[model samples]
Target: MARTLAEKVWDQHLVRKGEGQEPDLLYIDLHLVHEVTSPQAFDGLRLAGRPVRRPDLTLATEDHNVPTLDVLAPIADPVSRTQVETLRKNCAEFGVRLYPMNHAEQGIVHVVGPQLGLTQPGTTVVCGDSHTSTHGAFGAMAFGIGTSEVEHVLATQTLPLKRFKTMAINVTSKDGRLRPGVTSKDVVLAIIAQIGTGGGQGYVLEYRGNVIENLSMEARMTICNMSIEAGARAGMIAPDETTFAYLKGRDHAPQGAQWDEAVEAWRELRTDDEAVFDAEVDVDGDALTPFVTWGTNPGQGLPLGENVPDPEAIVDENERVAAENALAYMGLEAGQPLRSVKVDTVFVGSCTNGRIEDLRATAEVLNGRKVADGVRMLVVPGSMRVRFQAEEEGLDKVFTDAGAEWRSAGCSMCLGMNPDQLAPGERSASTSNRNFEGRQGKGGRTHLVSPLVAAATAVRGTLSSPEDLV
Candidate 1:
């Protein structure tokens, strides 16, 4: 039978098929855990006297509550310290591999997995965090699981899940490529804006066509990382030469003859030409510009040159209510130019946009420029390896010279579990995913943008694009 790429991968890992309303049991190839969500699951195992069924496939990292400034010092917050220590204790007892804070390999689970060649095509991957969809960039069947499911997978190496319908997001341009300065982040923000936040509910999104094919692996990951925000079960791209090239030499990737065999198998991991999707959406990549979110949700966005939307003008009743709430929380006035909204902070890091390429892009824009007076800018790499690469290329110096704080990596201000966060009523132009109220800190406002836009906003002290500074 002709199959979609997702269907092909799903069938490959199917340990048991569903009958009637029963969920199918799918084997998990990679299980990633973090401090915030795993402690309870570990305790569940201990209470039941259940051992981790496949410790070799499980990995743990400390990121959600770790500080970015001090690597060697003990965590100052009692709650944060306990979380990290508990993870250490659990991993030690369970025999699962862990990359603790200050370890050379330590970083965000999503970022570290791909960097270490642990995320590969045609594999089933899961994590407790929602952004685990980030691994789908490699054509893996990756999605987030809950704590109970975490225990289930740890105990059985399998998850009971309902099969998802597929949605094809076909992005193309009249010229067959995105315009320069319109990045993958812009493309994704534009998608959410077009479809609204719940458009992909109960669906697995397949990003395809010319625009997707042209994007680099890092850029693809950035797009897939936000699929959860769009309410998709996961998002994926078909494995191709770009996917193969990115995984060829990583630490955990197959080597020698095994590598050749793996590549041969991965080459077949694509949708059949005639396979159909439940729904389809098309985006004009050329028409997209650098985008920024004006309201709370990722969908509440517009091109950089647009104005804050008027809530009363919204046609949908629910949308109008959401717009009103967003405007009230954001301190934005109707019809105010988004570019005129001043910012108190500029953050350039997260699993969504904290790779070496993201840092390099921000550095290129900040190259001889200074951050606006009084606007604090924080540049946290996604992982220790990314930090080392950035420093080796001197990208760190460019950011520090521009007055941004170059700090060690963890999931810093993206969700504000640690010290890197905004003060009350503070507004920021950030490169991370999501801009919900208090996502960065209590009473904080977030404007999500691309790295280029983030650097430009840091200089201009407003939501901006590189053209604004140029």
Candidate 2:
């Protein structure tokens, strides 16, 4: 049978089937936990008198509430501190390993998973965070779960789930390859623009075609991480040479002859040419351009050089009203060029763009330039590996010397889970995925951009492309 990539991997990991009585039992290969979502799950484990069925499969970290500036003291926000404390207590009680705040291994759960080689191809990964799709870069079937589901996995090391429909999103670049200036961010934003916010309902999107195959692993991750934002249950890229190369010698990747066997199995994890999809979408990679979000949702985005859409021109009254309100809250003028808009802060980290390539792209702009006087610039690595690499290559020095604050690895400002956040009324140009209201903090306006755009904006103190700095 011609099976989809998702199905190919899922079948390999299924421990039980969906009979008349229960959902399919999916054996999870990795369970990433963070402070905000793990306490209750651990407590549930204690109450149920169960130990983590496979502690080796679970990894915990303290983020979202960790202070990026000063890790030595108690967190100032009492609620956040309590959350972190609870996680520490829970990990201790369960005998599950944890990367505490400021520890070298501590960072965004999604980021640490990939960098440490925990995100293996053909694996099933789950987290309490929605962006777990980021691990799809390695050809894993990864998704986020709610608190109840989190507890269920903590107790059973498996999930009861109904299968998702398969979809193929083919990206074709008429020019034979992706354009020079456009990025994976542009590709995803272009997709959202065409399909709207709810396009991929009930489907697990599989990226295919020449353009998609050519994207770097990090780029592929950027595309996958926003699948949920497109209303897809998850997104995946078929395991390939690029995927194998990226996982070859990582800390957690399978080694020796076992690696060869793993690779052989992963090679079969592709959608057969004759496989059918419930839905399909095509994009011309050449048509893509650097993109920036203009409103509250990630879908409310436009090409960087494009103007903010005039809400009045929107035919749907409801969408128009929402746009109008978003415009007001964002302090943006409708119809104004998004690139010309002023920026108050520049953030270059998160699960989305906190890897080495992201830092290099940002550092390329920060080489000799300084962050604009009033604009606060933050550079947080996504993991200790990324941090060590950046520091070894002096990327940290470049950021600090460029006048941006270099923070420890964590999910800083990605969702305001930690002390790194935008204060009320402060607007920021961020590299994270979402731009929802209060996503960073109350009244904390956010504009999503590429790492290059983020770095350029930091120097210019305005939303802009790296070409402007060049």
Candidate 3:
């Protein structure tokens, strides 16, 4: 039978086929653990007296609650300390490998997996994280699971899930790529803007065409990481020479002759020419520009040069209501220029855009430039290893020279879990996913942007793009 890339990967991992409404039991190739969600799952295993079924396939890291500054000192927050300690004790008891804070491998679970090359083509990956779709950049069928599902996977190394319908997102351009200053982050924001947040519900999105294929692995990861915001089961890009090049010589990737064999198999993971998708969406790469959200949801976005949307002008009743509510919550005036909105903070780091490449881009923008006096800029790497690499390349100096704080890695400012959060009523231009109400902290406002935009916003003290700096 003809199959899509997602379908082929799904079939390869099926332990048992489903009939009627029965869910198909699929084998999990990699299970990632973190401090926030694994506690209850580990406790469940303890109560049931069950050991982890595949310790070798499981990896844990400290990220959510770890301090990005003063890493050597004891955790000042008692609640965070307990969570980190609990993960240590549980991993020891369950025989799962853990990379604790200050360790080189320690960072966001999604970032660590790909950097180590454990994420591969035609594999099934799961984690207790919504951004697990980040692994789909390698052509893996990855998705986030709840605490109970976490327990199920830990004890059995398998999960029973209903199959997902496939959707193709074809991105084409007159020049075969995005223009300078526009990036993968803009591409994804444009997608969510075109398709409302629930547009991809129950579907697995496969990104294709010249625009997608030309992106670096890190850029592709950024694209997939935000799939959850679009309400998709997951997002993926078929593995190609770019994928193999990124994996080569990584710590966990296959070596030598095994590498050749793996590549050969990975080449067959593409969709068949005659395979059909459940739906299709087309995006013009040439028409896209640097995009930013003006409202609470990812879909409430416009081009950098556009003005805030007028809710009264919207014809759809529900959309108008949402726009009105979003404007109220965001403190934005309808029809005002987006560039004129002042920002109090600028954050550049997260699973969505905190790779070495992202840091390099930010540094390039900030080179010989100074941050606006009233704006505070924070540059937290995605992982300890990423921090090391940036420092080795002197990117850290560039950040500090520009008055941005260069902190240690671990999901900082991406959520309310860590100390790096926005104060009440604070507004920021951030290079992170999800700008929902209080996503960064209670009563805080966020504008989702790319690293280049973040750097420029830091310099201008407003929502901006690199062109504004020029």
Candidate 4:
């Protein structure tokens, strides 16, 4: 039978089939944990007197609440400190491997998994964080689970899941490649804008065609990372040369003869030519310009040249109501030019765009420019290893020389779990994923953009692109 890429991976990991209406039992190859969500789960296991079924497959990290500025100092917030300490105790007692704060491999769970080569093709990956969809960039069947589900996986290394309907999102560039200044981030925002936040509900979206195939692995990861924002259960790309090349020699990746065997198996993980999807959408990648969110949700986005949308212009009553609320919270008026919007902050880090390639792109734009007066820019790497690589390549120097503050790795400012956040009513051009109200801080307005756009906005003190600064 012809099968989609998702179906192929799902079948490979299926441990048992469900009888009519019951969910199938899928074996999880990796279960990633973080400080915020695992505490209750660990307690559940203790209460039930169940030992972790597979400690080697479960990995934990201290993120979400770790301070980006002081790695070794006692965390100033008592609640955050307790959470981190609890995770340490749980991991020690359970024999699960943890990349704790200040450890060389410490970082966001999603980022660390991929960096350590633990995420691989044709595998099942899960985490308590919604952004766990990021692992699908490797052609894995990856998604987020709830705390109860986390405990279930801890005890059994398996999950009961209903199969998701498949959606094919085909992206093609008119000129055969994306235009300069247009990035994978822009493409994803464009997709979300085309299909509202609920469009991908109950579906696994497979990104394919010329444009997606051509993106670098890191860029592909940026696309999949935000799949949850569009309400997709997960997003995936087929494993190919780019995927193989990225995993080639990473620490946990298969090696020597095993590597060759793994590649042979992964090469067949694509959709068959006759495969049919439950739904399909095509995006014109070459027509895309730099995009930014104008309202609260990611779906409330427009191209840089456009003006803020008027709620009255929306035909759908539900959508119009949402637009009105978003504009009020964002302190934006209908018909205002998006490019004219000024920003007090610019953040360039998150699992969505905190890789070394993202920093390199930002640094290239800030090479000889200065940040605009009064605009505070923070550049946080996604992981210590990513930070070390950026410094080795002198990218950190470029950011600091341009007046942006260089910070360590963590989920800083992305969800405002730590010190890096905006004050009330402060607006920012951020490279992070979500722009929901209070996502960065209480009453803070966030405009999601690419790293190139984030760097340019810092220099121009407004939502902008490298082309605008030039």
Residue-by-residue lDDT tens digits, candidate 2, 317-387: 98999999999999899879987888888999988888889899889889999999899999988877788
The C-alpha lDDT values of all candidates are 0.95, 0.87, 0.95, 0.94
* Backbone clash numbers for all candidates listed: 0, 2, 0, 0
Error of 1 at 314 (Å): 0.7
**Which predicted model would earn the best lDDT?**
3
RMSD after CA superposition, every candidate? 0.7, 1.5, 0.7, 0.7
Runs with alpha carbons beyond 4 Å of true place in candidate 3:
none
Clashing pairs in 4: none
lDDT of the structure predicted as candidate 2: 0.87
Weakest 10 consecutive residues of candidate 3 by summed lDDT: 171-180
- Candidate 2 has a TM-score of 0.97
**lDDT, model 3, position 235:** 97
Q: State residue 380's C-alpha deviation in candidate 1, in Å.
A: 0.4
Assess every candidate by TM-score: 0.99, 0.97, 0.99, 0.99
